[model samples]
Target: MIGSFVLLNCKKNREKEVMMQLKKIPEIKEIQCLTGPYDILIKVESPTIEELNETITWKIRKISDVRTTYTLKINEEATDCKDDN
Candidate 1:
């Protein structure tokens, strides 16, 4: 699986509506409201890079009032660092 942290901006006053819309997508595992330039943050996962792109480009970006999306892909190497004990 692939994981990503996505920061997005929504139209003024549409944050809640956008959040509700975003919750319907299964690929988006988590969502949170923000305080800075970004209005919302989300975590997404997919089995393949192509599917991830489709989720971001089509499923996410297509949502009404969504202005922009900045994606931070989770480093697979770092995620493997777990307590060996």
Candidate 2:
């Protein structure tokens, strides 16, 4: 599995619209409105890196209000931690 956190910068006053659009995509697992340089954050998962790339390039980036995106791919091994529960 491949997972990534995408930080999105959108055109002024378009955050909500962009978020709504992103929610329609199946690969986007989570979307959060943020208060910072970036307007929104999205968590996406895919079976392969190629599919993820396509989703980002062809789908996400195609949103008219989206200005830029910064993607951080998760490293499962480094992030794995046993739960204290």
Candidate 3:
């Protein structure tokens, strides 16, 4: 499966609204409220890059009050440090 992390910064006081909308998306496996430059962190998984892009563009980005979004696609071949333990 393909995976990615979506960093979102929405309008002030709209985090809850955004979270509510994000939860409804099936590809969204995890969502967390954040601080600093980004207000929220989203973890998603899909079978293809095209679907991942579609979800970002048509679903998440379509939500009202979403100011900015940055997506970081994961490299599935890389080994995680945790796996060695």
Separate clash counts for every candidate: 0, 0, 0
List TM-score per model, in order: 0.88, 0.90, 0.90
Residue by residue across 1-85, what tens digits does model 1's lDDT show?
8889999999999999999999999999999999999999999999998999999999999997999999999976365678889
Instruction: Arrange candidates by lDDT, descending.
Output: 2, 1, 3
Clashing pairs in 1: none
Off by over 4 Å in 1: 77-85
- Candidate 3: the clashing residue pairs are none
Candidate 2, 1-85: lDDT as tens digits: 7999999999999999999999999999999999989999999999999999999999999999999999999887356577869
In candidate 3, what residue range of length 10 has the lowest lDDT sum? 76-85
lDDT of each: 0.94, 0.94, 0.94
Q: How much does candidate 2 score in TM-score?
A: 0.90
- What's the lDDT for candidate 3? 0.94
